[model samples]
Target: MERFVLTDAQWARIEPHCLGKASDPGRSGRDNRLFLEAVLWIVRTGSPWRDLPSMFGNWSTAYRRFNDWRRADVFKRIFDAVSDEPDMEYAMVDATIVKVHRHGQGAKGGLKARP
Candidate 1:
């Protein structure tokens, strides 16, 4: 009954790449889709791990699992699978989300210092 971020189809595509499947030999994840949703929740909200809601279970547990997956490169494979073809039809950079380097910002006499 949790609000989920991934559509059924998107979860379908990413599910196979997830670890701890029933078919795997080790301990199975309580719920792969749920775990994914929890991770996505962190990403979308930019919230600290300690602030992760109770619906997603323990924050520390999720953090540990996330790091485990990261070390195993599981996310990379999932990203590769799902992003096989990126849609560049409307790619644009927005200043609000973009960061300027200190040097680019005249920190140490940038353009103004130039001849």
Candidate 2:
């Protein structure tokens, strides 16, 4: 019901590739969608795993999944897939006016200014 919550249809499509086949027999709910959903929630919100909703699963489970995915380069794989799509392209360079930080303004009042 949350704004960023992934829909069942979306999960069905991504599950095959991301999670692969189901777990072995007698596997508890521990090896199911709850952990997967928790990981997705943490990533979508850009929040700490400890803050994951109880409905999704334990925070520890989510954190493990995130670290596992990172170590396995799963996120990079997903990005690569999306980037290969025909609709993705282009670059835009922008020069925006903004005040420079004091450290970035190098010797403006010194010999540098005279040149």
Candidate 3:
């Protein structure tokens, strides 16, 4: 399975926003990072939870942990934290690379075109 690479800097920003961390960044932080990586792998591959690799631990357990995090809005807090700092690797995109189809650009379509 492909891995989700979070840099140490990125992880530092994200770690504080995550739930269930001990006062020390010990076992719990490592477990939380692994759990997060599992979720990210599922998302990156667009794979069903059942197909998660054993390296990430059990698929069902990861899914349940994902739900727990979601219910607590942990993801939102992480997004809010990370979004404030624009990391260059993912920060910029060229609008020229995006293509629009004619229909999407307000061309007449469907029944109107058929008539």
Question: How many backbone clashes does every candidate have?
Answer: 0, 0, 0
Top TM-score hit: 1
Error of 1 at 41 (Å): 0.9
Write model 2 residue lDDT over 1-115, tens digit each, in one string: 3543556755554554454345524323444355566666666899887788877767886677667667868667656644554553465445555657767987555455555
- What does candidate 3's lDDT look like per residue over 1-115, in tens digits? 3445887788999998887788744334348888888888888999999999899888887888789789989999998998886667865677776878777899666675554
Name the runs in model 1 displaced over 4 angstroms: 93-115
TM-score-sorted candidate list, best first: 1, 3, 2
Candidate 2 is scored at a TM of 0.56
Clashing pairs in 3: none
Question: Where is model 1 poorest over a 10-residue stretch in terms of lDDT?
Answer: 105-114
Q: Give the local distance difference test score of model 1.
A: 0.88
Candidate with better lDDT, 1 vs 3: 1
- Tens-digit lDDT track of model 1 for 14-82: 999999998988877898888888888899999999999898899999999999899999999999988
Ten residues in sequence with the least summed lDDT for candidate 2: 24-33
Give the higher-TM-score candidate: 1 or 2.
1
Candidates 1 and 3: which is better by TM-score? 1
Error of 1 at 14 (Å): 0.3
| Top model number, lDDT | 1
Query: Model 3: number of clashes?
Result: 0
